[model samples]
Target: MIDSDLPLLNLRDICKSYGSTPVLNGVSLALNGGQTLALTGESGSGKSTLLHLAAGLDQPSDGSVHLDGEDIGRLDDAGRAQIRRDRIGLIFQQFNLVPSLNVAANVALQAQMANRFDAAFTAEISDRLGLSDLGARYPEQLSGGQQQRVAIARALAPRPELILADEPTGNLDEETGDIVLTLLLELVAETGAALMMVTHSPRLAQRLSREVHLSRGQLAVQ
Candidate 1:
């Protein structure tokens, strides 16, 4: 069970550097359950790097990240992978769906890995995203907007505690992006999950509950 007293996701004094070039320096933040936070910055401001660290795809040079009140830095690669599979949902600009899998299979993939697969749930999300009719289509067969919705559905199918999105709408047109963002906001709200989205658009950032700007490897409230 999650500890009620702890924030859903917390990062303290996070610092990451590749040899002599520092990407993040002393960055700290916390996200509570059901809260939506927007991360905005110019390119190369370490936004994606921060997301990667939080998602356990990378590690910090210093400090700790706690998810479900457990310190992830202490865990080995396999242990961290377990936490990620069971607790986090990731959506990326690239819409990383498997080419061989059909839509339905793609949405069910993560939940299957986490041992939480439910056909009903996957179908429900796909329907909500207007992808029920496209269940048999491959990722390559879909348009940009359709592909993004599919990514969102796949990330959200498992009902994770946190959602990490890195430029989730970067590849879409404005109208399509708006539709996708609206769906993401509404669905994530219904699931009561925390969202930390990285975007370059201040307009989109304003739509979230809170916004933070990352500049020069540091974060400042905006």
Candidate 2:
């Protein structure tokens, strides 16, 4: 069981730098269970860098990151990879579907990697995402919208506690983007997972609970 008092994801006084150049400074944020937040900032404002830290893909130069009560900054590479594979779901603007795998295989990839594959849950999410009929299709055979849905299905297959999305609809047309965003939000709500999405558009950011903006590597008012 999860501790209700602790946030699902937490970052404290985060700082990141490459050599002498700093990308983030004294950044701190928290994401509680079942809450959605929009991470917005201009290019090079450390939005993606912050996301990478939260996802355990990279370490902060200073401060700590915690997910589900585990301090990620202290975990080694293998441990961090496990956290991502088992506890968090990620969606990217590029979709990032496996080119060699069929739709079903791609959707089941993470669960299989985590050794917690569930055929029924995979099937349910696939159907819910309208990918049931396209299970046999490969990534190259699908449209941009379809591919993004596949990416989402792949992310949610493992029943992750937190979902991180980076410009999830950036590649689609306005109509398609709206449709995809609606479906993503609905599915996220159903799963009761905390979401932190990075988007540049205010319209899209407003779709989440609240906004966190960055200015010159520092947090700004919502």
Q: Candidate 2, clashing residue pairs?
A: none
Q: Candidates' lDDT values, in order?
A: 0.87, 0.87
In model 1, what lDDT does residue 159 have? 83
- Best candidate per TM-score, number? 1
lDDT of 2 by residue, 42-157 (tens): 89999989988999988999999988788988888999998899889998777878899999999999989988799998898788767999999999999988898899889888
Give one digit per residue, the lDDT tens place, for model 1 in 48-164. Answer: 999999998899999889997888988999999888788898997778899999998888989999888888988888887779999999999999888888888888888888999
Estimate the TM-score of every prediction: 0.92, 0.90
Top-lDDT structure, candidate number: 1
User: Model 1, which residues run further than 4 Å from truth?
Assistant: none
